[model samples]
Target: MKIKALLAASVAGVMFAGSVLAGTLDDVRARGKLNCIINTGLAGFAAPDDKGNWQGFDVDFCKAVAAAVLGDANKVSYTTATGKTRFTKLAAGEGEILSRNTTWTFSRDVDLAQTFIGVNYYDGQGFMVPKKLGVKSAKELDGASVCIQTGTTTELNLAEFFAGNNMKYNPVPIETNAEAQELYKAGRCDVYTTDASGLYATKMSFDNPEAHVVLPEIVSKEPLGPVVRHGDDQWADIVSWVLRAMMSAEEKGITSKNVKKLAAQDNKDKEINRLLGKDPLQGLSKLGLSADWAVNVISQVGNYAESFERNLYPLTIVRGMNALYKDGGLHYIPPIK
Candidate 1:
């Protein structure tokens, strides 16, 4: 009976695997576009502009994938999802890739059956309070009402922080950043907590930005990046390598402004040559992308550094821990060859 049960489980696994492998590349090709899920709205991450064009750091990653596959960065349909719905949408096959500012956590990585492609933003949970509250530190916020997003690492992190500090506070849980911002502005919550970068973006969106201040406490590591369903190895490789290509492009000093010109330059550096597909970006073509996939990504979306500075710098989120490892931070890419 035990052996029969084991055989049944094996057959079920194989059937599940077969269904998942059923031609995502062909679907994308036939649709002539890539469907990418992004945050409902987060400045410097995945928010749409006044013209309804999606543009931000995360948005660029999606465009990079689209460019690498379809040879056109604009060949993408952006689906906006909140924290509570992003994973469910992705798992339901609502989108090919989710480029929202999602953190890489143990449960989400292993138990949740999702593949975090790479860390595009290294962040931490922080608190933002009204300057008038006279609270200079997160430690002082005992019994305070904190606005937090439900269905996020922030929720767990907030609980751990308060428990560790031996403090009690009211949690005003909301579904989206927009709702949280409203609750915060209405004085419904004493503090708004999320990733440090997200807090900055939210604070800046307020009418009187100077009235709110982000505390210096970073409670949890929130390494935000792209993700996809776990079963598709081909899709995972395509997304993973796109992010790596961007990071490596930044490390190698290849920017969108000069990518075309640089692509025509000599192959003095083998790494650069391999990355730009000037000399076979090595096994990347097997993923159904052109030899110049990296070139297309760099030219269309710019390097990782460029994308960050474009959206994040404006909100005062400097490149501190998010900088490449060679530049004295923790950003590193796997080898192209």
Candidate 2:
């Protein structure tokens, strides 16, 4: 009958989808490396070192996932992506995880068929101007030409903020953060607008960091985090828990310096024991990852705070909203037990 044919087609469609989604983990295992997408050059978030090795806060997350899944932190291949091409690259399977500082939004989550694991940084848009500009507040720049990155939430946020304030300004749009910095330094624009954390990072990269000041106004909420493609629940769970493991390690006082020792001994605390793989945590097997996954992440990548301090401290970015829940910040992860 017609109804039977329709049901068979629906079942076949689901099976095809499942087969495609299920291959990410197996493919990663077979290849022995994780292909992680990152920003072209965003200091303190994702940038290459002098040796051409990628290292930063966001880069640490990619390394952590590599450690968790592959048992080796260095077994990751980095692909630099601009804002415009990041999603397409991710959806096309060009990269397994996008660890760039991308904002989590409704359209990106549902419409684009991607899943944001969780917020790594709670950020807000702000304006930065040269100290010589003599502009103390964002509102003071009514006719200022603003340098912003194209294909980002920043462009839309800049327009809305200006219009809401009954202000008019010229937009100096660029594609990458490096480009924005170049134009801003060249005086092509009077102000540079981005996340406040990024403003500090940009300032640090300048010839004289002290010559610029980030204004106090926070224009929009940007809960930036790692992302993965949709239809792969197991892959999504693996990535999500890898991040949570870092946070939980920080909360439990396990650091890269002591993670190996902690993993070797039996701890009295149930959660610590389970997290360190002294006791088997159920459901890890379903994800096709080892029981020592959390141990690998902590020992190799350190915890969330460690990664943040190592990368962001040079930029003088404080742990305002990135601190743990007990420390009165927004980074609260679910219970590991």
Candidate 3:
């Protein structure tokens, strides 16, 4: 009788663990695709082409996650979420992950019941103005009419920047980036402000890109990355590691073009071998992914650096803070082993 009781207890514990793991991974597999939330329409970040195919840095992150989970990068459905709706959509389980350019704020992590995962983009708030305005510095834009997106940190930052300079300005608040761009271009506002990277994207989309100049001052820290729901740890691990895999691939000189060849070769670097699945990646099977998960990511979506160069670099923005830590940037990744 004592032996039977012990056996039953052990079986029950194993069943419980298996049940929990299946709850998250099984749902994704059963659905046949990953639901990823992205920006509404920010160029070089998340935007749909004329053929309705999503393409950008944030879009690549979603594709990488899909590849890690489904072994097919194309198996992802993207949902567009604005600044006001991104968090709510994730909390409601509208998507498994959010790859929008969302900042990792303290309140957002603990109070909002979400995990930020990691920072993919190190950004700062900045302002942009038309060259016709002749504004040499952010401080010189005193009493200027400013166009800012509502429901973003930019509104608050704009207030503080102007106040800190002991100046007052008229604020023209809008809901979306398109609206803000219209207001600024139509002369309703003298300046527009947002993330510095966003400023570059917006200016590049203008009729004459040379007409606008982004201010030199950077005001706030905006560490942007992917996010997942709070309750599902297994799902979070899958998504978080997908991002880290991209960053790690970039760090180790693995790219889309070289991924297949490198995966076929034996190397002395244990981390690289394990990451490319030459050796067993211990935690991957537990995450409901194959040992070749990083291989799927690099082959499909490329590395972090590839995604950036393809999307943002074409717009002429420099990779100032987005470079790997070894390359004088902040893109550090955890070891796969």
The C-alpha TM-scores of every prediction are 0.92, 0.93, 0.92
How do the candidates rank by lDDT, highest first?
Answer: 2, 1, 3
Ranking by TM-score, best first? Answer: 2, 1, 3
Q: Residue-wise lDDT of candidate 1 within 1-337, one digit each (tens)?
A: 9999999999976654543444677788889999999989888887778998988888998899998888899999989988888887787777899898899988999998999988888999999999999998999999999999887899889999999999999998999899889999999999999999899998878788998899999999999889988887888888888888899899889999988877887768888887877776556757988888888998988998889899899898889999999888899788778
In model 1, where do residues sit more than 4 Å from their true spots?
A: 1-21
Q: Residue-wise lDDT of candidate 3 within 183-202, one digit each (tens)?
A: 89999999999999889889
Best by lDDT: 2
- Identify the runs in model 3 with alpha carbons over 4 angstroms from their true place: 1-22
- Model 2 lDDT on a 0 to 1 scale: 0.91
* RMSD of candidates 1 onward, in order: 5.9, 6.6, 9.4
Note the Cα lDDT for every prediction shown: 0.88, 0.91, 0.87
Candidate 1 global TM-score: 0.92
lDDT of 3 at 113: 82
Question: Mind giving the per-residue lDDT tens digits that candidate 2 earns over 1-337?
Answer: 9999999999976654542445789889999999999999889998889998998999999999999999999999999899999997787677899999899999989999999999998999999999998999899999999999887899899999999999999999998899899999999999999888889999999989999999999999999999998988899999999999999999999999998898999887889988998898888799898888988999889999899999999999999988998999998889887
